[model samples]
Target: MTEFDEILKLEIEARKKIEQAEKKAERIKQEGIKQAEEVLSQVQKEVEDYRKEKQIELEENIANLKQELETNFKLRVEKIRGVFEHNKERLKSIIYSVLGFN
Candidate 1:
């Protein structure tokens, strides 16, 4: 073969090798991007799940606090009613005594 032909052949082979290396590098980069996306998706899902769980827990806590407040209010009302009834009875007795009915 001529020297020019040999050089041309070498140049062609080098170009093929360079193309192959570029294709390999592109494939590796795509795979890395795919893995990173998957990891991000998983993390996002986990964060959403955690947020939902915390919201549920907060709702439960709020419900329990409301129940406690309601119970305390009812107890306070009962005590007030008892005191009012007692005072009313005493006033009745005093009126009866003053009227000479007792």
Candidate 2:
């Protein structure tokens, strides 16, 4: 072949190699995007799960605090009631003496 023909053949082969490299780069870019999307989706799901778990724990803590407060309140009320009961006779006598019925 002539030198011109050889040069033309080399140019054509270079272009084909460049086209193949570009196609490979595009595929690699697409695969990277897909992997990034998958990782983002997984992270979002994990965050949602963690939030739900924390919410449940918070609700349980609130319930326990409410129960503790209610128990403390009931105990205080019972003590007041007992004191009132023990003083019932003294209160009645004082009221009667003030009304001149003692």
Candidate 3:
């Protein structure tokens, strides 16, 4: 064959290789995009699950704190009642002495 024909054949083969490379590159790019989307979807689902778990935890904590506060308030009220009961007799005796009723 002539050198020109050989060069032309090489050019054709090079172009086919380039086209194959381009197709392979495009396939790789599409696979990468698919994998990225899958990862993003998984991350989003995990984030939603985490958010729900945290919300439930926060609600439980709030409920526990409310119960603790209510218990503390009831205990304080009971103590106050006890103190009032203990002072009642002395207060009456003092009032009678002040008014000269004893």
Q: List the candidates' TM-scores in order.
A: 0.85, 0.81, 0.85
lDDT of 1 by residue, 1-102 (tens): 999999999999999999999999999999999999999999999999999999999999999999999999999999999999999999999999999999
lDDT of 2 by residue, 1-102 (tens): 999999999999999999999999999999999999999999999999999999999999999999999999999999999999879978999999999998
Candidate 3 C-alpha lDDT tens digits along 1-51: 999999999999999999999999999999999999999999999999999
lDDT minimum window of 10 residues, candidate 3: 81-90
- Runs in model 2 deviating more than 4 A are 92-102
TM-score (C-alpha) between model 3 and the true structure? 0.85
Candidate 1 Cα misplacement greater than 4 A, ranges: 100-102
lDDT at 98, model 3: 100
* Model 1 local distance difference test score: 1.00
Clashes of 1: 0
Q: What residue runs in model 3 are displaced by over 4 Å at the alpha carbon?
A: 96-102
Candidate-wise lDDT, in order: 1.00, 0.98, 0.98
Show how many residue pairs clash in every candidate, following the order shown.
0, 0, 0
